[model samples]
Target: MATVSQIWPFERRRCLKAHGIITLLFLDLCLQCVNGYLSSPHVGQEPPYSRDAQPVITSPVVPSPSSASPTDSDGYAAKCPSGGQCNRLPADCINCSYHHNCSYGKLASFSCKAKRGVHCTAESGKQQTNFSLSITCQFCWQLDLSQYRCSNSTSCMTVACPRKCYNATCQVLDHVHCLGKRVFQKRLYCNWTGGYKWSTALALSITLGGFGADRFYLGQWREGLGKLFSFGGLGIWTLIDVLLIGAGYVGPADGSLYI
Candidate 1:
């Protein structure tokens, strides 16, 4: 019985030692499994180490056009300059009357010889003002009254013209001859009178004609002395001179055009 008891104790001790070694091996395997689970990547998330390497996202910017009107340095719109004016003709104008319709501004009007059938027509023109660089465009229509446009050829028939008068030269006709001519075909001419201001001469002649005042005022020194000595040609010269002076026929001794 003692031998059997000793053998049973020895076998029990060996079995206990084997169980302890197995337990230690099982614990080491569990630790390895936990470490592998933590190191693996998640299904829908990036790895922590790769976060900073990703590129940043941004929206692009676009520019828009400007919507503003142009203005001068004075903050005002450009306009016509000084001494600039326009004159529009009447609707019923005829017989080359349209030629008188003109506009005068910073620049002079364009001139072209008129053909027999060709006549003046309305046209547009550009005028510049000192205030701005932009141009001032005007339609061709009105006549510019600010300018004086007249020539000697066209001055004679203005009063008798079928159209409006731009310039006319009228002379006095002899009373007897004028009344006798029924057709009045003859061209009337004004009596010869000095061009030295009819008003001034007439005033001086009346006030001092006997003293040769009219002649002296007309720059006629020799005629003035003769009239003064002749008592104005015994008053006959004074009467004739008064009539002649009233007419525009007589011009300045210097032959200069009337003012």
Candidate 2:
């Protein structure tokens, strides 16, 4: 049997050991509660736990619809059809491409130019010359027909709308004749003779100057025959050519430039 003094000490030691065990159990309960709020130990060591702590009060806050995106005032202007974002766009935005769906190069080109029509005049020469035409009045080229009039209203030269450039009985070279100059007659055509019939002689000179071929152009049978036989006054045709123009044997060819 334990004595009174020994029993008292033994009881005190048992009480202390019991208290320590209770304290350890309380600490373990505290750690279990903290596990709900925080992560578990990474390796093996348990985290510090406060034995005097109490449960915390919490009320979670939620988002509202209006606050979903306060920054977007226009609510995103529907991406540029060009497939671009609401914040960015292709060059063809003017064409209403919200997604940038059009070709990049084509969009850039479309934005670079404007629509316009073609305009022309004799003087406004440009990069596209063939696309324009002269706007000058062409009435000066019209033929006059008052010279062959027999009476106030009766005229041998009728002003037909469309006739040969130089029609007979139509004031015969009225334009140049009024200027008092020599002109071809219908008697013997002068392809190249000295006269106001400037075109035929010029044409003949350009087409037949080499072989004295203009002899045939002027309808001078004798001269042409001689030239063909002797090769252009190689013998004396040149002398004849000089004499004829001086004597007025030849006139402008094609009569009155009718052809």
Candidate 3:
């Protein structure tokens, strides 16, 4: 009972509604596919977003097997001795052997062992394999208050001790140790004068320095001759020598201090 125009309009509206429903369903299907692809792990790729995924745990980087051995500054691997004996003594202990008898001070030497290991380059520019470092230490000792008692008039002074000691007491040479072995034994005063006198040196310098008498007494032949020819640098050297002898600067030619 409807007209043709009304029927056509109704059909067009129904077609439009069906088209909108299909478009909506197709858009929803596309969104679901995109979501599935993003959440799932693919070949050589991880999921962009995943609720079941665990936190990534990476392992620490380890050094190669070739780099396991210890190397020196020059990248040469340190070699151990075959005899199993290494020079573990410190440099100071080794150089103590070269010091003069009754001498005590900070000494230095390059041939001494710094640590327990065979050095790639030694003082002779050759690899040292022997662990035994030849050393001939002079007789030395540390002050032991328990060994002896000091008189009331006896004075004590501090001195630079190469080895550890108590109270910095003036110790005399009693024994010697080198390369971890006792080598010598001799009871001698460390502060021995060796026949040098401070008062005599000062007196000669003040009275007859121009004549080179102090230099001659100190056993300095060259300096004595030079002073004799220069007449003590026209009295200027004489005054300086007097000061030096008085202040204990000019010592005996034998490397011993004045008494």
Best by lDDT: 3
The lDDT-based order of candidates, best leading, equals 3, 1, 2
Model 2: residue 93 alpha-carbon error in angstroms: 73
Output the better candidate (2/3) by lDDT: 3
- After superposition on all CA atoms, how large is the RMSD of candidate 2? 44.3
Per-residue lDDT, model 3, residue 144, is: 39
In the range 168-208, model 3's lDDT, one tens digit per residue, is: 32223222232222222323333424578889999999888
TM-score-sorted candidate list, best first: 3, 1, 2
TM-score per candidate, chains pooled = 0.28, 0.20, 0.31
User: lDDT of each structure?
Assistant: 0.42, 0.36, 0.52
- Which candidate achieves the best TM-score against the true structure? 3
The C-alpha RMSD in Å for every predicted model, in order, reads 42.2, 44.3, 28.3
Off by over 4 Å in 2: 1-210, 252-259
Tens digits of per-residue lDDT for model 1, 121-178: 3323333211111111222212222221222342332222232233223222211011
Q: Report lDDT (Cα) of residue 106, candidate 2.
A: 28
- How far off is residue 46 in model 1, in Å? 99
Q: What is the lDDT of candidate 2?
A: 0.36
